[model samples]
Target chain A: MDLPLAIQCEGVSKRYPHFHLQNVDLSFEQGTVMGLVGPNGAGKSTLMRMVMGLIGPDSGSIRVLGHAMPHDQIAAKRHIGFVAEDMRLYESETIAFHMDFVRSIFDSWDDDYAQVLLRRLDLNEKQKVKGLSHGQRVKATLVLALARRPSLLVFDEPTTGLDPAVRKEVLDEMMNALADETRSILFSSHNTLDVEQISDYITFIYGGRVVESSNKEDFLDGWRRLRLTNPHNRPLPDLPNIKEAQQSGQIWTVTVNQYDDALPAQFTQAGLTVTAVERLTLEEIFLSIVLSAKANIQMKVAS
Target chain B: MSTSIVPQLVGKDLRLLSRIILTFVVVSLIFIAILAAIWDHVPAVVQGNFGFILLIGPAGTCGIVMLMKTNVLEKEKSTQAFIMSLPVTVKEFTRAKLWVNLPVFGLFWAAISAVAFYFAFARGLFPLGGVPFVTMVFLGGFVAYTCILAVSLVSQNLGMTVLCIALFEMATSGYLWAIAFLNPISQHIWGAVAVWNPTAVGIVAAQLLVAVSVIVVTLLVQNTKRDFI
Candidate 1:
């Protein structure tokens, strides 16, 4: 059976004086983790805020757990656990105080799970939020969000400023959150490795637009970097899904998005000798996608 | 499942601000006690002036601090996002702030006003004629506070919030100086019986009107806000 959609954002757009997110459409099924990968100022937080109903879109509609956004937000938020990088608890208050506060509002708060998380994450309940280090604060907030046992989790760069061990710990806890199979998560991060590790689906957003979004496997399988021999110094032939091309002497490096077994045969048919076809990592793929999109926007402006 | 989260949000704010609230209340009460103890030692007029200064100063500071902590600081420190993450809408959050701030300040205002009234009129500490003046001053403070609260809620900017407080405070000083010299109010400043002249009543009525109007307008404006955080 097809899973219900946890989030559906259709043609959503938001405008500011300096930026505009235009005609964006995104959705993901329940029980799947969708990682939103974007560089700074790429509108990831804006999109997540819309999903969390903290802000309304300028146009189009967003639904979280089947409830329309900004209207049914109070209802939709009941099942959503949101933790953004900038989000903070009461500074003078203790972690215990925050947990109690969250417990008071959410009926789904699991005390047992909270205690487990606290112990596992090595958080001191009596310590004030102001006194905790950055990593500790992130962990505390994560515990608070997770202990609510929300059906949908929306995180915006949860592991943004952390040491490697802490980042891994956070990523591990995120993976653990999925053991239930009913919970869905949409997390935004520029850290492609974290996204690649935990996300079943990956979305790359750049310059207020979604550059690419697909399942992790599809992303891993569909992108390839080919080093071709161009002894004749002839121009590269037109190829489908050519993301970027660079030439150094007789060697031509070309990145393609729609890679398949038949791509090499097509290269041969075009009088280009494929020297090597290499799989692109998510980081390389993300960078290529963003650069390609930026180049496209610049070309459009020039035209 | 569809119940309003205003109460819980209000409760959370109350809990977070409990210590500050307690400190202000205790300090205000102690100040009142010290003033009452020295009531006969100092001249009545001087004592009354001191009392008004002492009471309004701390009360105003308390109200400003509360507004800063709950409204301005929440946005500045990004705790507003944390609160918004909960099962509450921006409208509900605004309502919770209204409930948290107005009533708490109202209670503080009313309690101190009652204590001042009892000492002045009931305890015969000052002439009853000062009642209308004192009431106007107290109500004026409420109006100033409501203005600050409204500005804090709408702007959510620390600079604007502080500017609103400063401007209102200066305006209040000017208002007090001007009203003290008014013929109707000045004539009754030392009378044995209280006089409810049209000027005194009008000032008090206007303060109440402004206070209520600011709060209502704040809520209406907040309801229309599309982006909260």
Candidate 2:
């Protein structure tokens, strides 16, 4: 099987009473990080849960690391480490107890690696799970998941409770885990910057559907905001792949997905001044994609 | 990247069930010591009397661990990206629970049976000698195991389950005199349950029935689509 893709999901559909997760097709190759970004209730968590075999999709085929879930999820999970935003550890137990308990069960557990992570994360061994601060709790979860040294690590909103400083450290540790090259990560987050910072590929989910998925650099570079003046009073052609456009006074600011050096010349021949053409950041691209999806939905409703 | 594939579902299940078994052992040993202390003075057969407590150990512990994140995919981070990134199947995941459940019950059953055997010999209470009473006690332990599995597998509230055990006895009037007077109106398991030689094989039947029920529920859970509301 050439060790099938780490995640290969197709035509995944899940319907809710008020919201429907539509045809969520996504894939992540081995030895790469894929960041999943979506607004709340956009089905980011739902997708992650399905991958973990925590939940099943309404209609879909999912193969994670060559195992057809969740029939094989048990066997497959052995090599996988998962940490959620609000993972509940035994509140009454000391971190040491949990460490010992987790260590005893998995043959892959590295006691030496665990010790190093604990110190690096600055967590005290004697600290009780309940007594740990929210950031400390996240760090503790990371410590447990990381030291196990699984081939794949799945983090769901891992940085949710951490402050900026803690978040950066956690991200650095995550990056450190991926330094081995064979290890892969799939994380869901609202923080686009985090998504942009570490993700080799990015997927945008909005209102239970994936609006966009592409390489991070390609996504940012693909989007262009060009300034144009409409001198002929001619409406722009309804071009396919033109995600969105905005008008300010006589200037028409158009957002195009596949931007090129030729864009300014086309507007110049139309007797409109081509003032500026600028590349958009991932955050701006994310907003445009979401807004465009909303517009598509609204337009569909109106007609 | 060790050559061996990871099996964390079963692995985690083991860790989870270990604490549960530990708890049961701790609680059971305390009761056994108490039973050993009271064996001579009490008229009741120690083997027959302690069946219910023994039954609840394995399934109850597994249930508590499961309940810890019962809502993991339900109420918490059902992260689409993260969960999908693993290397496992849903059925394999659910099977890990059963793998953990059976052994836990097996351990509990083994422990209590040993205790029951010891207590039966130490105490003089007998059903024409304690062999038949021992058989009956084993049967009750089986029923308790099955009942614990059935209730824990399906139940959402741990407190209510424990309460149900107590309420059920109260409702059926399970005491000896109540059994003597109300035998005509008594229920199936309840009527003969408290007796010296309660039907051990019959309780085994109940256990099988519960085991089947759990399998059926698990299949339903397995095939059903997870929307994660």
lDDT of each: 0.89, 0.68
Where does model 2 exceed 4 Å of error? A1-3, A230-234, B1-145, B155-229
Best by lDDT: 1
TM-score of 2: 0.73
User: lDDT by residue for model 2 over B1-229, one digit each (tens)?
Assistant: 3222135545654654455657766777676666666655655634456544543454345444443333132124332223233443444444554566656666666666666655544443432243433444454444444444444434424565566555544543343334333333233333323343345344446546765775677646655644322
Cα lDDT tens digits, model 1, A85-138, are: 899888888999999888988888999999999999999899999999899999
RMSD, model 1, all Cα superposed? 1.7
lDDT of 2 by residue, A160-202 (tens): 8689999998999999999978888999998899988899999
Q: lDDT for model 2, on a 0 to 1 scale? A: 0.68
Best by DockQ: 1
